[model samples]
Target: MLTNVPGYPRIGSGRELKKANEAYWAGTASLEKLQLTARQLRRQNWEAMQQAGIDLIPSNDFSYYDQVLDMCLMTGTIPARFKPLLERLASPQSLELYFAMARGYQKNGLDITAMEMTKWFDTNYHYLVPEFDTTQQYRLLSHKCVEEFREAKSLGIHTKPVIIGPLTFLLLGKIKDHSLHLHSLLEQLLPVYLQLLTALQEAGATWIQIDEPYLAMDLNPAIHQLYINTYNRIHQAIPGLQLLIATYFDALGDNLATALQLPVQALHIDLVRAPQQLTTVLQQLPAGMQLSLGVVDGRNIWKNDYQLSLALINEAVQAIGQDRVWISSACSLLHTPYDLDLEQDEQVLTREIKHWMAFAKQKLHEIADLAQIATGNNTSLAANMAAMQAKQHSPLIHKPAVKARVAALDESHATRKSPFHVRQESQEVAFQLPLFPTTTIGSFPQTAEIRQLRAQLKKGTISSEEYHQRIKAAIAETVKWQESLHLDVLVHGEFERNDMVEYFGEQLEGFVFTQNGWVQSYGSRCVKPPIIYGDVQRTHPMTVAWSSYAQSLTKKPMKGMLTGPVTILQWSFVRNDQPRADTTFQIALAIRDEVSDLEKAGIRVIQVDEPAVREGLPLRRANWDAYLQWAVQAFRIAVCSVLDDTQIHTHMCYAEFNDIIDSIAAMDADVITIETSRSQMELLEAFARFKYPNEIGPGVYDIHSPRVPTVEEMSSLLQKASTLLPARNIWVNPDCGLKTRNWPETEQSLRNMVAAAVQSRSAVLVN
Candidate 1:
């Protein structure tokens, strides 16, 4: 009746902490080989959740770049522009002032920038937001969850420690003085989380898991009385600290009697995302309270249906009986993928779909066999009920012409045969581009010899005519280096893709793939996704032969990138037996037949992208209009079958498009390339208070900040995005992909972003 695990998978199953934090940010590794690969990936993720017996094993969820920026450098919550790199990186801490506040400090000449990242609630896993102000204070800087709980109690492993809750760290921070009273910063951050949970209950932690995922969001009534005065002032300052709070992805609806008036002993809940709030948190169980039950699916790879987690662990062990019921993980397997048995023998799914599948070390053995079949020890529920009846009669999961083209789509297959001012006067008379046009957001710097010729053409030792004659000579040397950075809408440089949704989930049909499943997606990035599992279709023209061979080596308007069917169904590992808007309208009619075969292969500027469509919204604005009306009709059924002089674009990353700027201008997408340089153009104040009529490339340089942005800092963020939009609906790029940057900072940041779109088209012809 025990087994918890609100976190694990600190990126190692061959990411080795993304190659030791990019070889210690390229000084070729050290700081004792990146703290010996973060102490051997936190001792192989605490020896694989203590050999999967896991009784609440958590310990600071290891991070080099975000456990909410390690609780904003352990509650000192710096952000006054990283307090002068945390007072020249010393007694305000260092690891280069925590990677110059998570990447943005121009070596020694001290240039700063980086604090603001989003999506960690609606997880595609990015965090670093915490800015706080109204004279922000709070103290206990970094005991790093009590030195990773005495480094897992000197490896004898008595773990638990997890931390983040001073009301979800001031409700995932960034108050920046909106007269900053998140209840006076959670009562000035609850005595620095009661001196960091009384130093993890004097370093032998009985149970500390604090993480209050904002009690599964959508709270009010003063954030449910600031989670009842921050857990009744840490249960009256450590009244024998047990804590465990944790809610996850969703539901705790009407905040379940303010989460059973929190005098926290244990709560957990997310029975694979709101299993009808487990009959109201086991009928409000509080006497000697303890429930846990998250019942496994920590953001999907799918598999543990040990008869639906032993019927919700035998109804929370018959209403909190078996020693107050436990069985965890519906939240942090850090959004899954560390080991589907390290995806051995190059798994492409079918060995009966790899026994239905399960990563994060088989979800810590499905939360220790749903706590040994709710304590009866029913032998791992007979091979997870024969891989859940062989994945429900799998004839490799149905198609019938991809369910009759997502049941013959409607809304005229998602509109667009010309609008946004008639596709901006037919894309300005078909590409006679100039005023402020510069492009990118399709990859460019995936080097290391293009990931070793896409790993020697997937190890057939590089043949398919020597990997397309070395990917058509790296797409004719990146279309002559984006025409020597004069860049006016050009981009073949996907460099024979690997992941922008696993290169269109490897040519689409019911997708499989996994040679070490990857995952991370932020700092030192990771990806590898592609799991979708059955009934998405278009098995050809997946990027019209390298975008019609980079549009016959470019005459400028080349683009054609593609990842969008709601970012290939919000970055894959999907198929939970249908209706994620019917697998995003069968991956938007297979990216609308690869955007009408990339406009019949003459490819006139495609793009697509959908950077995880605001990481699939719905963290409850009463479920964001049924998930933004089928994610703006699956990005208008994947670029509405082209030709309003075919332009189409779409990019979006750090998505806070001010509460979905009318579902991102109803995703009509005639050019949207967002992510305003880490909020410098401040996400162009939501396309300038929604006067947003398409075309807004607003990224003037922050390809995830390695810091080479300066042609007067990309012409002062394209002159603060032309005083917030319509200097002819602006377009200058770079806030997203330069595939995790490096070709001398992607050629001096697109030559300081095409000299800041030619100095914002000479300040728009000097006003």
Candidate 2:
């Protein structure tokens, strides 16, 4: 049996790629210099995987931005808006155009909006969603995949080139014209894949791994047939080339039968998510076809149980001979950190938790070891099993106080003091605001000056008093701006914070901050997830001082922004010693303390963001109920401490609320704002159908892009939202925070947003 991984993290160990890309964007580094840095990182990643004894090392997975964006670049799927940037380019092929597509560009009086980005199938990672039109044409714009394959081949690694499957590419994309279908362009799309495959075959590649993760979702028969036809055509076109159709993130379910019918050489299924499918798969898989068994956990930081994984691999091998079974990771290592050894401080990570944990590097080694054990080479298996057993029984993991507190929890703790109607009346009386209140989703820009000041403070170059003065000044300035814009709700701009979760993690006990443990959240967006160890609790107020200070500056209500418990737990490198729910509840209690403290300090409108809650949903359907139950309870326990008049609010972004709208309502927040600007409020149909009984700020403009929305555009979205639900239930805000944006775009966007709110007031007041 051979060990294989579909992909690995493209961001370098110390975030070399992030630094390089930033320097290039800043005009400090040349394109050649940035390309050199990327080349070095990619070489290091391939070599690391190679050294781990991986037989089917993957190429073309590494991208400066996102893989989907790379595909867009390769297939010449450039939209018409980017034509100006391309025309002005000095070189025939400039990465500036690529970067423009990923992040919108504004230079020399030209402006272009970025394509929409959303959650990559229930993970924290985000991808650029493709946009297609009938007039969209495809060409071999770049030979990147073929070039990478040759590069790896020169380095003595005949790697399997990985590409996003055509079916998945079309499935994730939306049609530019509402009257057209994205799948209609599939005929044109298949040629690009076919040409790429022929090129890879010529580049000395024996096999190719086509990632089609969408197959795991609940696909309709038409979509399933599309998958079959797409693969069948490719298989027919490239008869000599071996193709492995890989699926991950969940079970194949009904798609299993369809997948088995494909004429590919092999099919990879995530045995880690749906282990029960192994028996059916082995029995039903046609003879002579290969089965790549994904047994290692690629999503979590926890170490694999070598014995259990080996047994599963053995079962597949027993059914379909060892020659036909390939052991691999359940999904890409894109979701995990690079290495555990980088976490040098044992006092923080601890030996106990460290023993139970595994990063990407360690995970690769686990896959190799599992392959060894499955192949009847148990040289080090017994020792690893003994160590695992000993760590499971470690006393350090079992915190008696934490367990007792969790067990003592009852329904009262997770419920609001009053119903939604009562809270709504009290909130209206407290604020006396007009319909369609205009507000931001917390945080203004985290400018370079702010980032530099923060770095100085961290390095002890600035005093605590000096930092506090700067933060207060920033908040005062933000309040002045909001007042100038005539916004109903204000925020402090979060100048005192570096990241939403890391700021709170620094104040709370049992959480350790990292200096360079950055993991890629999306394109050029790397987040250093705080390490949560031991039982969590609050020793002092986290956001009370900032929120209270901001409120003092404005007559308009300043929303107390805090990251929710579920979000904190989801965004952090959590402790694997106990159940995630236990860790989550502990985080909730800590947030509860902060919420109560904020309320006492005269902070009325609290906005706790749980953007990661939906992303944290388990991949499997059977496992979702248990996770959501605890996750919802955790969110409630954090904000339920306040009285009805306090007007508790929560914000969620990059989430699909349709499946969990009931749980969202269950949180009992007086107001809930979600990301809808990218989808143009398409996400709210579920809320409309369910009659979601709370105030909602379905975002009127997409903040993630640089192109500012016009007043008419924002007004049009709010008008559409008004048609869905009671107009009073609607609020106006940007899709997400403005931290990543510049001052110019943010100012224009908010001005337009306020105009849209004013225009929508009549609709809101009609009933």
Candidate 3:
């Protein structure tokens, strides 16, 4: 059997791409330097895969921004809005034009907000949403996949070029013309895919990995049939070209039969997520069709259980000969960190915990080793087996106190004191703000100076007291600025916090920090998700002091910000020994402790950000109910400790909550703030149709981009939102936190937002 990886991390070990991209954006580096950095990273990635004995290395997966955006460029899916920007640019083929589409462009009197970005599947990674129209044409705008394949060939590596499959691409996109449906463009779309495939065939590429992860989800019969037709047509068109249909993240239950019937050379199924599917796959797989058993967990940070994975792979090899079976990761390694050896926290993460962990590079080695073992060479398996055996008996993994606490949890621990309406009335009396209360989604900007101070604190160049003083000063300035804007609710500007989840993880017992484990969240914005190792417990108050201090400095209501249990669990590379729900519940209880402490310290308004909640929903609808039950319960467990008058607010960003409206209401947050600005109030339509009982803060400013919305634009969005729900039920805010943005844009955008809210409220009163 051959060893393969679906995809690899594009960000360099030290986030070299991030630094180079930022330098280019800031005019500190030449475009040539930026291109050289990208080329270097790509070459390094190819070389690493080749050296790891990967027979099927993937090319064209190294995206500067996102694969979805790359597909948009490749297929000429540019929206009409970006036409003016392209026309203004001297060179239309400039990467700046492409970057402008991913991130908004604002310079030299040209201002354009970027296209909307949403979470990719159930991960923290965000993708630029593809916008389509009736008149949209399809052509090979960028031969990125073909070019990358040639580059790899030049390095003596014959790699399989990866492309986002047609059906999945179409499903993720939206139609601009309300008169036409998204599927209607498939006739024009399919031809472009054929052209690209034919080009790859001409370029001497033998195998192409077409990722159709949507097949893993519960699909209607028609959509399942659509996949049969789509792949069949492509198969007939390119007779000699081999197509490998790749599906992961969940099991293909009903779609399994449809997938097997497709005319593809090979099929890849994730055994890590759905091991039960292995027996069925072995039974239904057609004669002479190759099977790629994805036995390694790609989305996790844990060491693969060599005994179990090898057993599964050996079963497949027994059914289909070893020549026809390939070994690969369950998903792309894009979800993991670089290398475990690169980790810095020896004292905290520890040798024992590190022994059981494997980052992306280590995972590649495991895949290689598994291939070797399956081929009857067990040299690498000996140490892996020993480590796995030792971990099973480790005392660090089994703690009585954490188990006792989890067993002690009851129904009462997950219930609030009152219903939302009663809580709303009391909260109204306690705060007494305007019809449209204006607030931020927490986190004012993290400036260069703030980052420098944090680095100083970490390096011991500055004392802890000095760090605290600087953070306090930053918070004071943010408070004064918000008050000047006449905002209703205020935040302390999370200057001391590095990340929303990482900050809380640092205060918790079971979590550990990394020095250089950054993963790309979106564009140049990278996040280092904390590693959750052992049983979680909170010993002391996490956010009380800073929240209490901020409230004391302000007359307006101050919101104590905390990352929710679900978001914390979803964002972090959590321990895989127990059920995910159990780990999530543990994290919830810890946050509950923090919530009670903050309420006791006089924080009347609290916002627990659960932006990852929707993103964490199971890919299969059949599995969503079970996942949501515990996920919602976890959120309730975290916030139920606070009184109704405390006004629990939960914030979600870059999510499509239409299908999960009932689930969102189930969380029972007094006022739920959603990310709607990028959608231009399109997301609010769900709540509008549902007539959602809870109050909402529908974001009016798109904080994801550098472009600041004009007062009129913000007012128009508020006007539209008011028409959807009662004006009194709607609050005004930005789409998400201001951490990724600069201070100037954050301030200007908030100023415009507040003014719009004031104007809209006045108009509502007039009506």
Candidate 4:
């Protein structure tokens, strides 16, 4: 009888939050105005959920930036580096701390940088990494949970507040000082969690969902014991509050049996992913414990089969009685798009294929409907059943041509025209460059003027001709800057793109753009993921004009930037009715056309960035090879369309490549760049172990931080990299693109990068 929706979308239905935040950051909008906009959006969300008949609506799920960062601020887990800035500003509220943690702060004397952010559990969503040192302490900042609960109550809506579990928080955090193990910090961190839970309890929150998704991972014995100990203490301390320990994305596996015995009120299992675990789970369910069955897929856009879902709910009911069963989503809907109702294009097949569809709003309705049917509130589920049946039988779900092409895909599509050795010989004769050539990872800083111009173009305030001219001018200036620095392999600055993926999606058929379908990719960063609604094909060239124009401006080999096929599929709200391999192959075919066109346009270096390639991997390692097979084939299909002498390059961002080193080599890119500065070239060991033969550019400096790298620092990093990699196989670059950095840091960092490459070349000669 406990119907609930997982986390709600935070980007705002109309993307009002993204616009307001950007405007405030750019000084175009006032702080008061941004605050008012977020408050209004929150109210609208609460009202909408209330009208939808959601039994246990969630609060504190709405984040101005990131919920994990919000948790850090709420528990007073501020790093010492940020404390002085908070003191200098003379504003020490939770909101101030949260924003400072997200955007960072620099006044006259005090300089504080934000914590390092990385992807959240293989999803595009990012969480701020909490910092811990020897003197780490805990205190409740502003009672955020209590405040949000009170705010919702005043609006006549009682809500269950959500908070990140202490175990998961520590699992995601970093120990900078290295004085304490993770378990040591938990003792100090747990008191604050206890305090916050007590406050929420006092504030009349009957239930709280403690998100410990780390339980789903392969945990060590010590960590497993720690989870047991931590929950025992919390359940004993906070006896009044009903605790729902939610584990998602995959089954809890060995942890499931132990987790079921924990002293919690309810156990939320992801039936959509691990439906087989249901029978085993039901057998082990304690007499009084409730079951929150996550029948709706939270991470994807697939519509639930109402008939199938009802049968599963009935099974749970028969196994554990109707009173003990509830319906929910497999994970948080924060990963999903905002509302499907806003997408107005009838040509977008996904919109019309509503049976294979459910956004956050629709999922809530599904939960409520499932709950009603279980409670005997409705007799006939025929209408919803028929709707689902029609969707499964739709022509849109299957395309014979697409299916045939994928089936006929051979090893030749996954292989280059020639082997790496042959390609390398040809590329060396063609490029004729230095031993340690330097280049950037495509984009430069996306300035406010450029953003405004894009916004204006989108709003029809600027003509396409005028916009094209402006972008060309920007690219010219950027090329000039790179030439002045005397760097090799110049990029066109990616001035024409709003995002790497969105740019290609605009030119590709079977993809639909959304004006307001924004989803948070990281702290204060939102991406409007294009929806792949049908069989994809490239209508025309996507990046040829900009690459051609930049090449015309400079004699240096300009790199043609394209988002790889796997990344395009990963980042977009892809069609779920078909296997992802089919979608990726379709995208690969489209990008293949662009690659051939760019090569013909005289762009010798093309960097196809597959940053999200690792994100698409299945959580379980057993299922990795099948995913990697198609993923590598997609990359090969895209890049093999180019000539051997064209010097095909691929870039990966913030991924551990140890397991996939062979697959990466299998892709056969002429050159590969990976993010390595953060891990201190530890990631490059994979290349060394695999004896990876292709050229590599292990990033010489971390681009995420604002701190300018000295030439010595970058030189040292390059030296360390040379020890792990063959000097002949090395190139020099930053960890990722420079879009997130300011002009000052971007220029300084690239200068140091070039200097380091020079230093590296000299050192190799002397050795």
Each candidate's root-mean-square deviation in Å?
22.2, 2.9, 1.3, 3.1
Model-by-model lDDT, in order? Answer: 0.81, 0.85, 0.89, 0.82
Write candidate 2's Cα lDDT for 464-529 as tens digits.
Answer: 899889888988998998999999988889887889999899888777654556789987789988
Local distance difference test, candidate 1: 0.81
Per-residue CA lDDT of model 4 for 155-210, tens digit only, reads 99998888999989988887777678988889988999999999989888898988
TM-score for all models, in order of appearance = 0.36, 0.92, 0.98, 0.91
How high a TM-score does candidate 3 get? 0.98
After superposition, which runs of candidate 3 have C-alpha atoms over 4 Å from their true positions?
Answer: 89-92
Which tens-of-lDDT digit does each residue in 30-87 have in candidate 3?
9999999999999999888888889999999898889999999899898877788877
How much is 575 displaced in model 1, in angstroms?
3.4
CA error at residue 303 for candidate 2, angstroms:
2.5
Candidate 2 Cα errors over 4 Å, as ranges: 80-94, 107-110, 178-183, 461-463, 576-579, 618-627, 723-727, 755-767
Pick the TM-score winner: 3
Of models 1 and 2, which has the larger lDDT? 2
Once model 3 is optimally superposed onto the true structure by TM-score, how far is the C-alpha of residue 660 displaced, in angstroms? 1.2
Model 4 pairs in collision = 303-356, 303-357
Angstrom error of the Cα, residue 615, model 2: value is: 2.3
The window of 10 residues in a row where model 4 has the poorest summed lDDT is 347-356
